[model samples]
Target: MAKSTSGLSRKRMGEMYRTMLRIRRFEETADDMYMAGKVVGGVHVSIGQEACSAGVCAALREDDAVLTTHRGHGHSIAKGTRLPEMLAELMGKVTGLCRSKGGSMHIADVSKGHYGAHSIVGANMPMAAGIGLAYQLEGKDRVAVVFFGDGASNNGAFHEAMNLCAIWKLPVVFFCENNQYAVSVPAEYSTSVDDISVRSKGYDAPGLTVDGMDVAAVYEASREAVAHARRGLGPSLVEAKTYRFFGHSRGDPHYGMYRTKEEWEGWKGRDPLIVCEKMLKMTAKQKKAHADAVETEIREAIEFAENSPEPEESVALEDIFA
Candidate 1:
């Protein structure tokens, strides 16, 4: 069941709506670019899970850090990553945040404390826990937030990372954006228990559930979790129960295969963008204006990406360590 969010203010609600729009437009462009071969190595689209990214990002401070998965564009956008650089990175251009060496799945903007994203399933969780450990050692309160899917929660790395964070009392928040599928495997078939949150008890961390469709619910939950971590409290886990409108990746045809058309429609009707727009009290005209602005921003970024020069061959091994 989607969580209730009735206390959000008009301004904050408007921001959430805009952020969703930004993600939608940016991803739309990415899809087109992928089809055109501009975005190399392909990408996992986050067309339906905007709320989880935008909401959780809103709750993070500038000093906070995050690690994301292959389906990471939304997370990057939510962290205020510059659209031009992100797009350039996807294009493998020199102007990219990663100097075009890291391409789509490895875009990193450490300036934003994003610490980069990972293509390997369940791998970033351990890295995020390590970041938390470093912060503790340095006597800093920076919290490390790791985003993964329900499928990742079942991996050995997930358990190991959770145990490490727990034993160390690390300031890490393991936020699982469970979109109900792990690349065509429905979550119901993968896990014995229904809710992923319950697994946190094994690590002695507080487990929580939030409305991944409602950006406000995610923001509230993330805010509380981050505050606790910043206070030197131990790690926590948040299972955002959400659904993905698209397939797990650009190639997977999720519609009418694993789920029914009716199920997709039911979730789409409650699109987080629409939810936030309604909460902002914005009429159709106002909503359209904001949406158009976001679209425009994305368009400029795409244009910049298309025009950016690709990385030179000489630098292929620049960042690699033997």
Candidate 2:
């Protein structure tokens, strides 16, 4: 492994590797649970793209706000949400975040500064701007980070929010996890631009593209973006070129449906976990021990979620305003 030019401490690099491993293991467990019918509804696992969430969130402070899309379990975990509660929420149990109302798509922990994950396409972009506005009005140094997909980047909301954020000099970072496909459609077919970061030019903000499979690359880019926002330099766009190992959702037959096995294997070859492990120069034994520790933690989370009681049927109507 070459010496890290990113200047990250050995401890921090190890921590990043552990964090990515946790996200990978958690999503793998969730996929198994979903297949076994334990987790109801659909789940959008961020399997291969864990580095984006973990690296970006690593650059954020505890008080910094984050808004993510439906495929957000990784982002939630990276942003400091409790694993057990998040799993319980996915299971629709009473002990879950939002008391089981939000389910997988809407998991949130305001205390952790994660506003919530949205199911609507591109909905949170403007909301992130609003959160940044609130922080600005409050005269705080906090910044808002919004994660969206390549598909959402084409939506009007993304453009509108970026314009607003740029004009107002709002402290926000628009992190686009461009995993190639917007559901069944590839970015090549759906998007006009090669890199989503190019859209920032129209809004008069800085734009950067990073190799999302490299955790160190993502962390460095995010650190710069976060610093730019915190310094009141306004918003910036970071487009992470990555891939999702799973289907658009758990139900989709990812292979041969829209993508090929060869393509899948190509991305898997660049798996962030593998990349980081090589960078850290972890021995086989050390890798196994690290993986074992993450597995144990995930097992505990699964147990906690299983042991939790289901939400009462009647209470579903209670939390609703309409």
Candidate 3:
């Protein structure tokens, strides 16, 4: 939108816009379902952070592996997960991915190269490195992308995983969706550096931070980082400066006790939905049409999930990782 810095074509721009809308609508619908007590476990939303998910996944291939954080619905959607099955998974239906066993935090569709969504903070980094190593050993050019939050960046796993990937030159992209807050703790108080990407130097890898609200900026950065890893250039850290519109999970307030109303309003102004529409110069009719299409899709997904049967209890323990 700003002088074509990313230089994305109109088609790609529109596709990314659609992706952002799909994630936005999907999360909103899921949150509503959670509130209605129609889902299992808790729902961690990535509503305002759609640009980060959509932009990065847009740069990746369907066969490239992906590991997601708890707040990873958008990541799954961006990585080409079917709406019906993903929603069904959240609904704990037999038709869902993992046959309703994995529910919210553990939805895995390996057929699409999605390993799984790990609930433990920073836990999936090691798994990502392992996958990257597998690709390297097999002489495959595919890369592995792991998504985590700024809070997880401070964990020992962050350093250990990134350092390991860096030293071994593993084909992995350490993607960070720094939403500025980890649950109730603001990043300013917890993190030492203003930009998380700078810490990549500690592991002898390249890194950069981008406007997480701007999909074009994120897309360009992600494309290069993904390409870098695919070329056997080791790991790269990408930090997206973003803010979550909702609380850390379902039942949490928008500006809970810790966040100020002013801070919330400030970030709301840069809502990914608004920013994406503006970037694409979408007309009022076009915007409505896009949102309508997403709504229709989400509505159908909910019906499918609701109508699908739950997994049979007899087979409950059959497909576990044991």
Please list all clashing residue pairs in model 1, or write none if there are none. Answer: none
TM-score of each: 0.96, 0.96, 0.96
Q: Can you write out model 1's per-residue Cα lDDT over 99-211, one digit (the tens) per residue?
A: 88777788778899898889999999999999999999999888989999999998999999999999989999999988888887889999877889889999988888988
Candidate 3 residue pairs that clash: none
Cα error, candidate 2, residue 208 (Å): 0.4
Write the number of the candidate with greater lDDT, choosing between 2 and 3: 2
Clashes of each: 0, 0, 0
TM-score of 1: 0.96
Q: Could you tell me which residue pairs clash in candidate 2?
A: none
Tell me the tens digit of each residue's lDDT in model 2 across 1-322.
1122577876887888888999988888888888888886778999999999989999999999999999999999999999999999888789999887778899898999999999999999999999999999999999999999999999999999999999999999999999999999999999999999989999999999999998898998899999999999999999999999989896687688999999999999999999888888889998988889998999899999999999888877887685
| TM-score of model number 2 | 0.96
Error of model 1, residue 35, in angstroms: 1.7
Q: How does residue 148 of candidate 1 score in lDDT?
A: 95
Measured with C-alpha atoms, the lDDT of residue 93 in candidate 3 is: 87
Q: Note each model's CA RMSD in angstroms.
A: 1.6, 2.1, 1.8
